[model samples]
Target: MEKYMKNLTYESVLPFSEQVSYLNGQVASKTIAQNEALSLTLFAFDKGEEISTHESEGDALVIALDGTGEVTIDGNKHVLHAGQSIVMPARHPHAVFASERFKMFLIVVFPKKGD
Candidate 1:
């Protein structure tokens, strides 16, 4: 099998664009291949857009591809900027806000088998 595939661009996945339910942004995610948990997304948000507060079911991570933002965890606020990334533990209440028009990626990973 090939080691990689063509990169996914936002314009290439136009039909899948969807709004972030809890926040005032949108996302476009694409599974790169079937064998890995890795994926990519193009997220867009209006300035001051905020997602609804919530928690995740499993370990997750996020990367700010292009923009400024903030994340709140358990009432604590932390600033996020382009090229920044963070890992979030399962079930922790968190919220994300776009201080300006923003774009990011969300990643969910499961433990490898027989670790």
Candidate 2:
């Protein structure tokens, strides 16, 4: 068998939020997989930390794994808590802020090369 995931234990049960750890005043991330078609990442943010406005070529889905966070898309703000999720469309401006110590799982899907 081939492995498409990394930085994580295989064949085991685990919580996604536990994969990454929060820092005192920074954001920490763990990349589980990355390829042209998709990307999987886990993020932990300290209270008040943020990822400023940006645009991506792919659609990004954010799954709140722990605590609370703010997701701003197209200038509108949306709050997310544990067990919640939101999607930022491709080419749209978006940002993420930690309302408190927060953890999230991010999955991005890109268009195929010819599409």
Candidate 3:
């Protein structure tokens, strides 16, 4: 859902984890905000669920919020637990897997024209 807008303001503070819930045997996602330059998304994955390998045009930062997960980038694997984070470079092939029920925040930023 592309409902959240970049310039909107929230009236009250809310917990990010409570915004999305994990579904059994599936992965769930919520888009927190997005614009031409950046996007913010929250994801919840049940045990054994995964996002298949893919490439992105923008750099992405993955922040683990709960449980544990495995992130494979360019054929290398990294295990991440709560409070850990990793960056996936633009155009690199990457994938995400949940070792256990997990939640994470993903921030992706689009590169400007030229360098």
Candidate 4:
């Protein structure tokens, strides 16, 4: 059997927020899964760190794991705290900012190869 996920412990109960660590003045990411159809990533952001506006080919879901973050979609900004989630639609311009040290889990679902 092939493992579909990586960088995670199997058969253990653990907090997802602890999977990644915040770096001083930097954004760090751990990729759990990656393929043509989906992507699963965990990110830790230091205060003031951000991902500039960009568009994704797939719909991306962001779930706050710790602290706080600001999500900007189509020019509108939203604040997310631990346990909160938001979806960014495919092809829409979006950005993420860390108002304070924060952690988040991101899941992106891409369309099938043939529509």
lDDT of 4 by residue, 1-115 (tens): 7899999999999788999999999999999999999999999999999999999999999999999999999999999999999999999999999999989999999999888
Give the worst 10-residue stretch by lDDT in candidate 4: 9-18
lDDT tens readout by residue for model 1, 23-53: 4445333443333444344466678777768
Query: Cα miss at 41, model 3 (Å)?
Result: 0.4
CA lDDT of each candidate? 0.63, 0.96, 0.91, 0.97
Query: Pairing residues by index, what is the TM-score of model 3?
Result: 0.89
Better of 1 and 4 by TM-score: 4
User: Sorted by lDDT, highest first, which candidate order results?
Assistant: 4, 2, 3, 1
Looking at model 4, residue 11 earns an lDDT score of 91
- Give model 1's TM-score versus the native structure: 0.63
RMSD of 2: 0.8
Go through the candidates in order and give the C-alpha RMSD of each one to the true structure: 6.2, 0.8, 3.4, 0.7
Tens digits of per-residue lDDT for model 3, 12-103: 67776777899999999988787778889989999999999999889999999999999999999999999999999999999999999999
State each candidate's clash count. 5, 0, 0, 0
Off by over 4 Å in 1: 1-40, 111-115
Mark the regions of model 3 whose C-alpha exceeds 4 Å error after superposition. 1-9, 113-115
TM value for model 2:
0.97
Tell me model 2's lDDT, rounded to 2 decimals.
0.96
- TM-score for each candidate, following the candidate numbering: 0.63, 0.97, 0.89, 0.97
